[model samples]
Target: MLTLAETPPGAVVRVIEIMGGRGMRLRLMRMGLNLGDLVKVLSSGPLRGPVYLENLSTGVKLALGRGVASKVLVEPQ
Candidate 1:
């Protein structure tokens, strides 16, 4: 498994796990980032601070902070 933030841009990843408590988990869920969902990395910088992701299920675009994105584990497909 690899972190979403560490994945290369344009790669499709399946959300495998989320590491956080109830509040944080719920917040991420509301943003359409749920387990088993597939997301594509849209863009990233050199250090991977902020990344743009597109939720395949909802077709929603979200910019996630590196710290939060790092907690999301995914498998490339």
Candidate 2:
């Protein structure tokens, strides 16, 4: 499984698994990112910076730190 951190820009991916605790999951869910949702990577900052993406399901855009993004498992759609 590829992580959101490892996905390149412009790739549309589906959320498969979130390898973290309830707090993290809830945080993401509140941001409109949930399991099976489709998202596209908009851009990634340099030097282990945040990852910018758009949740296709809700049309919400967000930027997540690399550490947080690494826990979000995804598959290309």
Candidate 3:
């Protein structure tokens, strides 16, 4: 498993866990990210900026801050 931030661009991965407080988890959930969901790494901004991701199940694309991405654990699919 690896953090979402470490996932390579275009890689499809499954979300395993989100390591943060309840508010953080709820925020991600509201964005369509949840445990066991498949997420694709779309693109990463330069200079440690936001990382773009696509939720395979919902077809939603979102940008996550580096810090948040680092807390999202994923396994390559």
TM-score of each: 0.93, 0.97, 0.96
Candidate 3 weakest lDDT stretch, 10 residues = 38-47
Residues 1-77, candidate 1: write the lDDT tens digits: 89987999999999999988888789999988899998999997667479899999789899899989989999998
Each candidate structure's count of clashing pairs? 0, 0, 0
Candidate 1 stretches greater than 4 Å from native: none
Model 2, runs deviating above 4 Å: none
Q: TM-score of the candidate numbered 1? A: 0.93
**lDDT against the true structure, each candidate:** 0.90, 0.97, 0.94
Off by over 4 Å in 3: none
- Candidate 2 on 2-71: residue-level lDDT in tens? 9999999999999999999999999999988999999999998998999999999999999999999999
Residue pairs with backbone atoms closer than 3 Å in model 2 (clashes) = none
Better by TM-score, candidate 3 or 2? 2
Candidate 3 C-alpha lDDT tens digits along 1-77: 89999988999999999999999999999988999999999998887989999999889899999999999999999
Q: Whole-model lDDT, candidate 2?
A: 0.97
Error of 2 at 25 (Å): 0.3
Residue 7 lDDT, candidate 2, scale 0-100:
97
